[model samples]
Target: MTRVRVGCVHLLIAVSTVWVTQAQMGFVFPPVRIQAFSPRGIRVSVPDVEGITALLFDGNINKRIMYDKGDIHGFVTTKTNDYWVLDDPTVELHSGDVINYNVLLETGRFENSPILNGHFKSQQRHVVFNLERRSPPDSSLTVAESKNIKCNQSVTVVFNNNTPICSGQIIFEEDFGTLKEDVWQIEQYIPTEDPAYPFVSYQRSAVSVANMALHIAAKLQQTEPGFTSSSLYTFTLDLTDGCTGKMCKKQPSGADILPPVISGRITSKNFAFKYGTVIVRAKMPKGDWLYPEILLQPLIRNYGDTNYASGIINIASARGNEYLVANSKDYGRHVLYAGPIMDLKCREQLLQNKILVNKSWADNFHEYSLRWTPQYLTFSVDKEDWIHIEPGARGLVSRFPDNCTDLPRERLASSSELAPFDDLFHISLGLAVGGSTEFKDDLTTKADWPKPWRNSARKAMLNFWKDIDAWYPTWKQPELLIDYIKVIAL
Candidate 1:
């Protein structure tokens, strides 16, 4: 063991073990895993870089890898929790360099990335490593050739496929080229008890991707493994494996029953952005009371107190019904809606958020776009203008109903004009059937086809299930088809 000085801290290097103590997570640095992605570029993946900042090579090279956003390549996206950081392997170690001191470690959230919570602060501790100087691959070799021959994970030597992909503006993109769990998290939750009170519960089997496009289809609940037509109403169902909804469980009563439909939802919970433009190509389903949720919901509810306080930007929303008439008006697929959902009443959301067309959206696929910035937001369908929302000088409060009130006015006062929207938001896709708040109770023509259930009725699910013959047969296309989704940072 040898003692050395780094900046102001004293460090002890265990020459034999080559170990460094990470006190925050209680991890002892042992045998660092190193890899070469390029001819000269090398990276080290540490299990947890909690309060650490940059890793140093021979005390001469310093590169910030823990929280790097300068270059897209620097921000390595990984499925594992280990932190992968690019180290400048191009620089060679000189004589008398302290091999044990590999980390230029810094502690405290204030000195680290802003995303971290500033609840703890610590002075730099003794972190040291001992290593024999290992040279990088010869700089003369081409990247492709270097990847195949020198690669340790044996198979066919392929030029480093682990290299970062940097395209302009695009931050998160999915062609459904195999649903990546690190990106699109397939939901395994159910809304059975106090569920959104929707007639459907999310199941994995209902979601699939074919021909490079994702399809979220709705199926009969009885088709699930252990469920049956009569058993659905008999046994109490709980989606406890990954229930994102309510935990309360209640036995099926006379009118109250299980979710009669099986549907699914997926979210990009692993990734989020502050301001970005999103484009989605999708075809709406042709069925009664089916609603497609293509939305960007807030990652943090920094504004108001309620669940939807941070706001939700609806990329595109269209009903499945093609010919449902309401009060001499057609509220079917002929109508498309897009807007920022601020509150549940959100008169601004309900009244002014709709766009009309002569043709039904379910007839063909449509390109839905959202251009969100710090100032204004524009929603478009098929590249045509749908709604352009640029709030007044005071912000969105002016557009909302008076009763909406100063919903946590204190926070909004100090925020940008796009308070709720300016914060980070992620993408979500799902299909829902027959919900209370979505459909108005008074209107919605079920008379012609015999609307079985009232939106406000306590026995709404039972009523809809009893008259399945009427609506189920009308489900010409019960799948919410998503061709592709892309999010580009502004």
Candidate 2:
């Protein structure tokens, strides 16, 4: 009796399980199918897949689909083509389900986002189905609408079109404390990369860079959707306290001190010596939001203490230690702009020592070239005259002849000019982010700083963290594109 009862219970359980399985499998999804699209009208048909849940039609042509999961995430930008099949990702069918779908062609440039030009028609129009596409129906959403960032907090801004900034950092300053009386100091640091680290290698070093080229590019889509629209700026490269004329002259023998070029691809082995022009081309992202940068720093000796003074020299003009070189910037996207060599002619009287421009650089690439030779030095844009230094110009180098160590009378025989322009006579490429560092924001180009303020802030900054060794190093990959460098002997 017990064996029979147990057997009967097992049979009932198995039959109930089968009934539930069939019931679950019986759920049906509507399917819509399209025959073909033409200029005339639309045709419809029944879904051909069996056990199907739904039917979908992708009729938009040239539509790009960005996917996150199995579903379509968004649309990609297209240039000339329209009419694409809208991508659909969520339809799984079984053996016996059927659907019918048709499409209608679109004509002119429709203003709708996703710009739908086609329509769909199905045989069973009353059936409810979910629309399976990424993004809303409207496609005209600007970068601003996509990201909800406040403008005041945005530090890094991009210029795509007439759109507002979409992405940036909002530095929430957490005040620690001020330790000193005369000087207000904060001990906390962001622990970020110090830009002052010594540059180790460069692909190319040239005398000039091309003006009309792409300098930097950042793929913003994968980043914070905030860079959809940004403004671009263009500024003429300038160096303060620059050297030129007799004050800025170099000997042909001193070419060894020029920055060494390490190349494995070309037969030139290194940057070749040049006599005509010294142009330094660099690139920055185009548009008003990006800062166009050109910096030329002269080599100066650190006299240990009591002397934080440094003199400027022209690199192309100096033949030995105490040389100075002007650097230029040319915007290129992973490319180098070829330019002319430089010559620095001695000048007698000086007018202005710096090149100043007040225009904004946007979209177009620019070449900032400094032409220096034995006879004259000219600052130009794409070879156009921007500023010039005449022969035998007189300035600080002449007033402080004792301060100028490169002169024949000032240096001892042991202090050779051939000293690898490494320590006291070399130049550096740097961007100044003025905060509390010795580099303050000089909006007026002021010549002197208040003695107390300078001592308290600038002196303290240099004392605490000027040397590359003093600060921690942080590695960063920039967005600038660099190409092969060329050094020709003029």
Candidate 3:
């Protein structure tokens, strides 16, 4: 009788356990299916659901969520007494098959965030639902809208006739990554010394591309009695040895003479643009007697008897005596000159303007740009327009006397028609030292200069050269860091 009672008790316990399991099975929820995905967020659909009591989701989608002060937690929980908010959010859902919400958490607390387990209790059931996040499509990967386009990238410009101008895209760009030989031609030819200021020379070995930026440095070269600096020149393939064919070689000399200064220059002679915007980000070199120029040389050297204008867009002229006088107010040491030059023989400047910045140009990187159009040419520093030249502005004529016989017919007729600049032009970037005629004249007349330096500008340069070792260590730091040079057709 006792054994039979024990068997009956065991059977009753087993039956109760099965009944509890069956009741729990009725409360299970369906899995959440991913419908779509995007960079902004994801979409999901839940099936066979009536009313929801609690819904939880992972809020940390795009970025990591950290529990720190001032850190944004992009989630919130309502009905504070019923729901325990995890690091994620506990969402309360009404009866719906499809629900949409942003993946980003806009506002919430970061302290004691809860983990997402996809477990929730409904009005009629205790449920465990499977949630999935889909990956975004490949078409979603794209850059944001920018005014400046990358090299070789196409930009559509709509004309008045509704025709799209996409063919004249980015013509050239130099990021200084292992210098492309086909696009750039490094200059090796020696330049003739200017009679007014004859002191420095150009060298071929001074140009180099490293650390993803073009470095043009000036260093003292040991010479016979005095120290001189070398300079680098890019572009001007015509100035080089052979101009017979596309494949030209730079002239090599067996001369053992060492120049006092060594620098670097690079030019884009092969790539010329008619009307476009040219932008260059560069850091100027420090010290006295340094002239860093970003200019456009005309493709056609001469358009008649007169020499064609080489657009002097941006020039950081010598910070020596000329700058000292011009920039009397301690705004900046560097003197900025920008505009066009029509005749090289007379050296007349048309639409040129001078500006003084508030900081040393070598202290940080700044962008210098020139936007050339058929109507006008505008020059800017870091996108701030300091000089604007329209067609018929005063002093636009190439000749000053107004009765000069050598003035070009097109230029003489109307100053609005910008000659020499209308033709295609190539870009030139170079660093020159200690031979500016303007600076030389200032040193000769200025009484503010030091004793021996007041009369002789060359003597002051020599003094700086004597301490070259103390100034120039290597061509690495504080170089003319050319981040990039980009050209886009207007």
Which candidate leads the pack in TM-score?
A: 1
Q: In angstroms, give how far residue 389 of model 2 lies from its true place.
A: 3.1
Q: Candidate 1: deviation at residue 266, Å?
A: 0.1
For residues 139-160, write the lDDT of model 3, one tens digit per residue.
1211321111222322322111
Query: What is the C-alpha lDDT profile of model 1 across 20-81, one tens digit per residue?
Result: 22222323222234443322344444333444443322222322222112111222223133
- Name the lDDT of candidate 3: 0.44
CA lDDT, every prediction? 0.60, 0.23, 0.44
Better of 2 and 3 by lDDT: 3
Estimate the lDDT of model 1.
0.60
Runs in model 2 deviating more than 4 A are: 1-269, 272-274, 279-358, 361-363, 390-396, 399-409, 412-432, 435-486
lDDT of 2 by residue, 1-490 (tens): 0010111121011223332333344311212222222211222222222222222232222222111111111222221111122322333322222222222222222354322322212111111133222233233222443232223222221111112222222101111111111111111111112222111111221111232221223221112222121100111111112211111121112211211111100111111121223343333332111121232222223311111122222221100101112122212122211211111111111222322233322223344455434334455545466566433234223323343333332222233221111122221222121123222222111122111113224233223222223121210222232221211112
Separate clash counts for every candidate: 4, 89, 23
Q: What would the TM-score be for candidate 1 when compared with the true structure?
A: 0.63
